[model samples]
Target chain A: MTPQLEIVIIAVIVSAACSVLGVFLILRKMAMMTDAISHTILLGIVVAFFITESLTSPLLIIGAALVGLLTVYLTEALRRTRLMAEDSSIGIVFPFLFSIAIILITKYAGNIHLDVDSVLLGELVFVPFDRLIVLGRDIGAKSLYVMGTILFIDLLYVILFYKELKLVTFDAALAAVLGFSPIAIHYSLMGLVSITAVGAFEAVGSILVIAFMIGPPVSAYMITDKLRNMLILSTLIGIINSIIGYRLSVIFDVAIAGSIATVIGITFLIVFITAPKRGMLTIINSRRRRKIEYAMASLLLHLCNHENTDREEIESNRHSIYQHLNWSKKFLEKILYKALNLNYITLNNEYLKLTPKGREYAIRCYDDIGYSI
Target chain B: MQKHVIEVEDMTVAYEEKPVLWDIDINIPKGVLMAIVGPNGAGKSTLIKAMLNLVKPISGKVLFNGLSYECQRRYIGYVPQRGSVDWDFPTSVLDVVLMGTYGKIGWIKRPGKKEKEKSLDAIKKVGMEEFVDRQISQLSGGQQQRVFLARALVQDADIYFMDEPFQGVDAKTERAIINILKELRLRGKTVIVVHHDLQTVKEYFDWVALLNTKLIQYGKVDEVFTDENLRITYGSTDRVLKGEV
Candidate 1:
C-alpha cells in the first residue's frame, strides 16, 4: 500500500477507536476527563520506558493505561474532598501529573526519540514509515495494526458492556441498586480511554487525540436520540473527518493530525447549526414561533375581555390596540396578521372581535396560568 | 404479626461530618405503602438512599428479607428523584423503561422480545403508551415522572423505594403514580416513598415515618402522623403547620 493510503488508514482507525469510546465519555459528561487522561498518560509512558529501558516495549502501553486510570482516580478523590468542584479538581490533578511527565522527559529522556512537541501534536506523516515485519515479510504500517487492534477491542468492549454502560450513564443510583457496580464499569472505560490515547499518541498526539475522542460523539449527540445510533453515527463521522482531513493535508501540505482535528471541529460546528431537531437553527425557529403564538394568545385574551365590555369600542379598535399592549405598530400588525391567518380574531367595522375559537383558546390559556398559580 | 420486608437497623449517614440521617431504624412490613416525610433537608431522601446503599452509611446496616442489599438486590427496585437524571439523554421512553430489566437480563445480552413486552406493559400502565417511541427530552415534568414510575414498575421486585416521584408532576400524573403504588401494595409488594406533601400523607399512605436527622415516630398513619410528631419533625418552622393543617 502507498504511504499516503497507509497514513489515511491509520488516522481513520485512530479516530474510529476514539469516537466509539467518546460516545460514553460524552454521555457521562466526562469529556474533559479525556483531555486530562490523554495528557497525564505521558507520565506512565516515561516511567515504563525507564523500567524497560526500551521505547518499543509493550509495557509502555500498559503503563500509560494505568496512569490514565490513576488520573481519573486522583481527580475523583480530589472532588470527593468537597473542598473543590469537579472541574477544578481535574484542572489541578491533570496539570500536576502531566507537568511531572514533561519535566522527566526534558530532564532525563532528552536523548530518546520522545519529544514534548511531538507527543502533544503528533506527526501522522511518520506513521507509514513504522513498518511491522514478521520473518522478514512486510506486513503493513505498525500504527495500522496498533490502532486496528485498539478499535477492535473498543468495539468489543462497547458491545459486551453496552447494557451496563447505558444503565450506569443514564442512572448510576439505579445501576447500583441493580448490582451493576458502576465504579467498575467507570474504571474499565477510563482504562480503555487511556489505552486508546497511548495507542493513538504516536500518530495523532495527545492534544489532537482529545479532538478525535470528543468531537464526533458530541456531533452525533446532536443528531441522534438513540445510544446505538449515536455510536454508529460518531464512528461514521470520525471516518469522514479522517478522510477529508487527509485529503486537505495533501492539498495544503499542513499537519495531518492538525488537519483532522480541524475537520472534527468544523463537522461539529456544522452539526450544531444544522442538526434537524436539536440544532441551533431549529431552536431559534421554535423560539420565534412560540413568541408569535404567545402574542396571538394574548391578543385573543385582550379582545375576549373587551368584546362586550363598556370600553369595547375603544379597547378593541385595531388601530389603538398596539398602544394598550405597549408594542410597536409593526409587531402588532404581524401578530394581527398571524391571528387572522389562524382565524383567532375577526375585523368587524375596524374593531377586533374574538371568534368563538379565539374565545375558547383565551379561556384555556387563562386556565393554564390560573391552574398553575 | 406482619412479615417485615425491609429492616433498617441503626443506619446513620453523614456527609463530611454533617449528619444527614442519624441512627435511623425502621422495619417496613410487606403489602404496606409507607411514606417517609420531613421538612426540606430533613433526610427523607437520605433515608431511602441509605437503605438502597446509594449513600454509604457512616455506621449501621439495612437488611432486605433477612439478606444484605447486595445479595437481595434483584428483589429491590429504586426510582430516584425525577430531576436526578439528565432528560436530554439520547434514548426513547421504551429504552429507559427497558433498563429496569437489565438486572434480570444480566451482563451483555440485549433486551429481547420478552423485555420489550414487559416495558410496553409498564408504559401502558403509566398512560404513556403513545410516548413509548418518543425521545425522553420531549417529555414534560409529569410525563418524566410517570416514565420513571414506569421504569420502576418493570423491575417487578418485592420492594420498591422512590425518592420524590411527585416532586413536580401534575395532579393527574400524581394520581396515576399513586394508583400504581397502590396496585403494587395490593400485589403484596412493599412501597416506600420519600414524600414532601404533608396533607396527602394521611390519604395516600398506610404507614408514615416522621424523620428529622433522626426517626421521630413511625407507625400506622392514624397513630404516628400526628400534630405533635409533625411539629417535632419539622421543628419551629411553620412549613409543617401550613402544610399539615
Candidate 2:
C-alpha cells in the first residue's frame, strides 16, 4: 500500500497502454504525428489551465485531446491543399502552438503554482501521491484512473474499427469505395492518439513517451510479421522495458523515465541484431552459411564425378576441375580432406569411393539446397 | 427496354476552376459490362469519380437506379485505381472484403457472422478463397486487384463502378477478373469497368463507352464499335475517319 509501488504500477500500465496504440501508429508511419501531438498538447493544457484556473482539472485532459484532434484535422487539411508537405505542415503547426503556450506560461502563469518542467519531463515519483478517493475510500492514484480510461478508449476504438482502420491505413481509396470512410477512421485514430498523449503526458514526459509509443512497437515489428502478434509483442516489450528500467534506475540512482527509455532503446537494439529470419545478424550468417554449403555441395559433386579416376589422373585434372568449380585449391583440399575423414569418400591409391553416409548426405544436401532456392 | 442503371446528364467536373471532364452525357442499361476508355488525360478516371459522387462535377446530375447517390448509396459499389492505396497496410484479404458490408451494417455496429459469411462468399467468387487470410501486402499485383473486386462483390450491389481494375494485373488474373465480371452480368448485376486494352475491348466488354474529354460513343459492342467511331474516339483527330476497304 506504499506510494512507490503504486507509482511503478501506474507507470507500467500507462507505458503499456501507449505502446498498444503506438504499434498501429508506427505501422501506419504516423510516429512523428505522435511527437507533434505531444508538443502541441502544451497549448491545450495552457488554454485549459487559463479557463479552469486549476492544474488538476479534468478540463486540461479534455482540452488537450480536442487540440490533438484539431492538430490532425489541420495537418490533413494542409496536406490536401498542396501548400506544404506533411513533415513541414507538422513542423509549422506544433512549434507555433507550443511557442504560444510557452509565452503564455512565462507572461501570466509564471507567478502561479504551475510547473511546465514537470509537464515536459513527467514526475513519476509524485504520481502516486495524487490519490483518487471514491466515497471517502482511497481507490488508487488519480493518474491511474485517467490513464486507465484512456487505455479503455484506445482498446475500444481499436477493437471496434480494427478492420476499417487496417483497410484505410493500407488502402484509403479502397476503403472509401467499400463504404468505409478513411477520413472518419483517420480522425478517430488520431483522436485516440491525442487522448493517450494528453492522458499520459503528465505521468511520462513527452520525450520518454515517444520511447514507449514507438520503441516497443518497432522492436516487435522487427521480430514479427503479423499485426495481431505485433500488438501482443509490443505490450510485452513495453512492460519489460518499464520494469527493467525502473529497477535499473533504483539500482543506479538515475532518472526513472530516462532509464526506461534507455531500456527500450537497448531492447530494440537486441531485437534488431538477433530477431529470427529477418535480423541483421541472422541474414548475414545465413548468407555465409549458404556460401559454405554451396562450395561443399559442388566439391562433393566434383569428387563423385571423378571417383573412377586414378590419383595421378585426379591430381593432373585438379586445375580444370577447380576452374569448373570456381573454388580455390586450398578450400577444395580442406573440404576434400574433411569428406575423407568423415568416410563420405575414400582416397585409395588416387581413386575416390563414395561411402553410404557420404552418398546419403550429398542427396539430402541437394534436396535442401534445391528446395531453398 | 430495360431501365438505365446509370444516367449522367451534361456532367462537367473540374478542380480549382479548371475543367477535367467536360459535358459528359451517358446512359447505361442494366446487366451490361461497360468499359470507359480514353487517353491518359482524357478524364476517364474523373468521369467515374463524378458518377460515384467522389469528385464533385462542376455542373450536372448523376442518377443510379433512378435515384440520387444519397438515396441509393448502398445499391452502388466502387473500386478505385490500384495505385490509390498503400499496399503495405495491415489487413488480410478477408478483412478488406468484410468492409463491403459496412454500408449495410451502418456505423458503430461491428460486422457480424452474416457479414463474414458474405465476405467469404465474395472471396470465393474471385477465386481468392485460399488467400483469404493472407495480408494484402503479401499478395501479388493480380491477387491485390482480385481482393478489391471481392470487396466490391461483398457489397452485393446492383451496379458496380471499377476504375482500372486490371492496370497492373497479369493476363491470367485479368482473365479471372473478367470471368467474375461475366458471372456478375449473368446474375443480372450491371458492372462498369474503366479499361485500357483496346485490343481485348471487344472480348471483355459487352457494352462500351468511348470517351475523349467528352462522350463520343455509348452503346453495345456491335452497335457503336465502328471504324469511324474508333477513329473519332482514339485517332489523332476527331474529324479523321479511317476508311474500311
Candidate 3:
C-alpha cells in the first residue's frame, strides 16, 4: 500500500478506537482524565525505553498503560484528600507526572529517537514509514496494526461490559450496590484508555489522541439522546473527522494529526451550534421564546387584573401595562406583536384586551403561581 | 442464625475526624418495612451507609443475616439518592431497572430473558411500565423515584436499602412508592428507607428508627412516633412534627 493510504487508514482506525472510549469518558465526565493519561503515558514510554533499551518493545505499551493507571490512582488519591476539588486534583497530578516525562526525554534520553514534539503534537506523516512485515512480506503500517488491534480490543471490552460500563458511568453508587465494583471497572477502563492512548500517541501524538477521545463524543452527545446512539455516532464522527482531516492535511500541506484535531474541534463546534435539541442555538432560541412567552403572559394577566375593573382602568392601559411590567419598549412591542399574531390579545382603543384564549392561558399561569383572580 | 435482618453493633462514623454518627446500635427484624427518620445532619444517611458498608465507621461493624456485608452482598439492594447521579446519562428506565439483576448475572454474564422479565414485572408493579423505554432524564422527579424503586425490586434481594426515596417527589408518587414498599414487605423482603416526612411515618412504615447523630428511639411506629421523641430527635420545638402522632 502507498504511504498516503497507510497514513489515512491508521488515522481512521485510531480515531474509531479513541472515540469508542471517548463516549464513556465524556459521559463519565472524565475527559480530562484522558488528557492526563495521554500526556503522562510519555513517562511510561520513557521508563520502558530505559529498561528495555528498545522503543519498539511491547513493554513500552505496558509501561505507558501502567503510568496511565498510576495517573488515575494518583488523581483519585489527591481528590480523596478532600483538600482540593476533582478538577483541581486532576490538574495537579497529570502536570507533575508529565513534566517528569518531558525532563527524562530531554535530559536523559536525548540520544534516543523519542522526540517530545512528536509525542505531543504527533508525527502522523512519518506513520506510514513504520511498516509491519510478517514472513518477509510487507503488510501495512505498524501503527495501523496496533491501532486496529486496540480498536478491536476496545470493541470487545465495550460489548462484554456495556451494561456494567453504563451502570458505573451513570450511577457508581448503584453499580456498587449491584455487586459490581465500580472502582475495579473504572481502573480497567483507565487501563483501556491508557493502552489506546499509548497505541495512538506514536502516530497521532498525545494532544490529537485526546482530541479524538473527547471531541467526537462531545459532538455526538449534542446530537443523540440514547447511550447506544451516542456511542455509535461518536465512532462515526471520529472516522469522519479522520477522513476530513487527512484530506485537509494533504490539501494544505499541514500536519495530519493537527489537521484532524482541528477538524474534530470544528465538527464539535458545528454540532454545538446547530444540534437540534441541545445546541447553543437551540438553547438561545428557547430562551428567546420563553422571554416572549413571559411578556405575553404578563400582558394577559395585566389585562385580567383589570378585566373585572373599569374599562378605563390603569392596569389595562397599554402605556400603564408597559410601565408596570418593567419591559423595554422594543421588547414590549415585540411581545404585543407576538401576542396579537397568536390571537392571545387584541387592541381595544389604547387598552390591551385579553382574548378568551389569552384569559385561559393567564389563569393557568396564575394557577402555576398558586393564586387565583 | 440471627433473627434480625441487620445488626449494627456500636457503629460510629466520622468525616474529617468529626463524628457524623455517634455510637449506634440498631437491630432490625426480618421482613419489616422500616424508616430511618432524623433532622438534617442527624446522620440518618450515615447510619444507612454504615450498615451497607458504603461508609466506614470509626468504631463498629454491621452484620447482614449473621454474615458480613462483603460476603452477603447478593442479598442486598440499594436505591441511592436520586440527585446523586447525573440523570442525563442516556439510559432508559428499563436499562436502569435491568441493572438490578447484575448481581445475579455475575461476572462476564449478561442479564438475559429472566432478568428482563423481572425488570418488566417490577416496572409494572410500580405503574411505570408505560415509561420503560423512556430515558431516565425524561421522567419527572416522582417518576424517577419510581424507576429507582423498580430497579431495586428487580434485584430480588432479601433486603433493600433506599435513601430518601420520597424526596422531591410528588404526593402521588410518594403514595406509589409506599405501595411498592408494601408489596416488597408482603413478599417477605425487608425494606429500610431514610425518610423525613414525620406525618407519613405512622401511615407508611411498619417500624421506625428515629436517629439524631445518635439513636433516640426505635420500635413500632405507634410507640416510637410520640411527640416527645420527635422533639428530642428534632432537637427543638417540633414544628415539623406537629400532629405526626
Candidate 4:
C-alpha cells in the first residue's frame, strides 16, 4: 500500500476504536474519564520503561493499559468516599498521576526517544516512517496492526455484551437487581477504553485520542434517537472525519493530529447546529414557533373574554389592545396580523371581534392555562 | 395461613453513618397487592432497594421465596421512580420494555423474537402500544410512568416492586395503573408499591405497611390502615390524616 494510503488507514482505524467506546462513555457520563486515562497512562509507559530498560518493549502497552485501569479504579474509589463529587475526584486523581508521569520522564529518561511532546501532541505525519517488519520483511505501519487489533477487540466486546452494556449504562440499579454485576461490566468497559487510548496515543497523541473518542459519539447522539443507530453512525462519522482531516493536513502542511482534532470540532459544531430534530437551530425554531402560537392564543382569548362584555369596545380596540396586554405596539401588531391571517379574528371598525373558530381556540387555550392547574 | 413470598428480617440500612431503615422486619404474603406508605424521607424507597440488594444493608437479610436474592432474581421485577432514568437516552419505548427480559436472557444473549412479542404485549397492556416506536424523550410524565410499568410487566416475575408509580401521572393513567396492578394480583403475582397518595390506600391496596423509619403496622388494609397508626407513623400530625382518613 502507498504511504499516504497507509497513513489514512491507520488514522481511520484509530478513530474507529476510539469512537466505539466513546458512545458508552458519553452515555455513562464518564467522558472525563477518557481524558484522565489517556494522560495518566503516560505514567505507565514511563514506569514500564524503567523496568524493561527499553522504549520499544511490548510490555509498555500492557503497562500503560494497567495504569489506565488504575486511574479509573482510584477515581471511583475517591468518588465512593462521598466527601467529594465525581468530577472533583477525577480532577484530583488525573493530575496527580499524570504529573508524576511527566516528572519521571523528564528527570529519569530525558535522553531516551520517549519525549513528552510526541506523546502529548502525536505527529500522525511521521506514522508512515514507523514500519512493522515480520521476519526481516517490511509489512506495514505498526499503528495499523495495533489499532486494527484494538478495534476488533472493542467491536467484539460491544457485540458480545451489547445488552449488558446497555442495561448498565441506562439503568445500573436494574442491572444490579438482575444479577448482571454492573461494576463488572463498568470496569470491563473502562479497561477497553484504557487499552484503546494506549494504542492510539502513539499514533494520534493523547489530545487527539480524546477528540476521536468523544466527538463522533456526541455528533451521532444529535442525529439518532436509537442506541444501535448511534453506534453505527458514530463509526461512520469518525471515518469521514479522519479522511477530511488528513486531506486538510496535507493541503496546509499542518500537524495531522491537530488538523484531525480541528476537523472533529468543526464536525460537531455543524452537527450541533444542523441536526434535524435535536439541533440547536431546530430547537430555536420550534421555540420561536411556540412563542408566536402562544401570543396568538393569548390575543384570541383576550378578545373572547371582552366580546359582548361591558369592556368589549375598550379592551378589544386594536389601537389600545397592546397596552392592556402589556406588549409592545409592534409585537401586538405582528400577533394581530398572524391572528387575522389564521382567520381566528377579524377587525370591525378598529375593534377586534372573534370568529367561531377564534372563540373555540380561545376557550381551549384558557382551559390549558387555567383549568389544567 | 398464606405463605410469605418475601421476608425482611431485622434489616437495617444506612448511608455513610446515618441510618435510613432501622432494624425493620416485615413479611409479605403471596399474591397480595400491598402498599408501603410513609411520609417523605421515611426510607420507603430505601427499604425496597435494600430488599432487592441494590443497597447494602448494615445488618439484616431478606429472603425471597425462602431463597436469597441472587437465586430468586429471575422471579422478581422492579420499577424505579419515573424520574430515576434519563428519558432522552436515545432509545424507544419498545427497547426500554425489552430490557425486562435481559435478566432472563442471561449474560451475552440478546433479546429475540419471543422477547419482542412479550414486550409488545406488555406495552399493549399499559395502553401504550401506539407509542411503541416513539422515542422515550417525547413521552409525557404519565406516558413515561406507563412505559416503566410495561417494562416491569415484561419481567413476568412472581413479585413486582414499584416505587411511587402514581407520582406525576394524570388521573386516567393512575386508574390505568391500578387496573394493571389488580390484574397482576388476579394472576397470583405479589405486587408491592411504595405509594404516596393516602386517599387511595384503602380503596386500592388489599394490604398496607405503615412505616416511619421503622415498621409501625402491617396487615390487611382495613385493619392496619387506621387513623391511629397513621398518626403515629406521621408523627402525631393529625394534619397528615385530616383528609386522608
DockQ values per model: 0.71, 0.27, 0.48, 0.66
Between prediction 3 and prediction 4, the one with superior lDDT is 4
> How would you encode candidate 2's per-residue C-alpha lDDT over B1-245 as one tens digit per residue?
77888889999987776788889899889899999876667788889888877787889999887889878888888888878877665557887788778778876688899999999998998899899889777788888899889888888899999999989787778889999899999999998888887778899898999887878998999898777787777765432323220
What DockQ score does model 1 reach against the true complex?
A: 0.71
Model 1, runs deviating above 4 Å: A367-373, B237-239, B242-245
What C-alpha lDDT, on a 0 to 100 scale, does residue A277 get in candidate 4?
Answer: 98
How many residue pairs clash in model 3?
Answer: 0
Candidate number of the best TM-score: 1
lDDT by residue for model 4 (A1-373), tens: 9989998999999999999899999999999999999999999888999999987788888899889989999988999998899999999999999999989988989898888899999888788888889999999888889889999999999999989999888999889988899999998998889889988998899999999999999999999999999999999999999999999999999998999999999999999999999999999999999999899988888888778889899999989999999999999989988888989998899998999999999898888884242
Task: Single out the weakest 10-residue window by summed lDDT for candidate 2 chain A.
Answer: A311-320
Q: In terms of DockQ, which candidate is strongest?
A: 1
- In candidate 1 chain B, what residue range of length 10 has the lowest lDDT sum? B236-245
lDDT digits (tens) for residues A284-346 of candidate 2: 999987776677666666665555566436532544456667778887677677777777777
Shift in Å, residue B174, candidate 1: 0.8
- Runs of candidate 2 with Cα error greater than 4 angstroms are A133-138, A281-373, B112-114, B226-245
Better of 1 and 3 by lDDT: 1
Of the candidates numbered 1 and 3, which has the greater TM-score value? 1
Q: Rank candidates, DockQ, best first.
A: 1, 4, 3, 2
Q: What residue runs in model 3 are displaced by over 4 Å at the alpha carbon?
A: A368-373, B112-114, B238-245
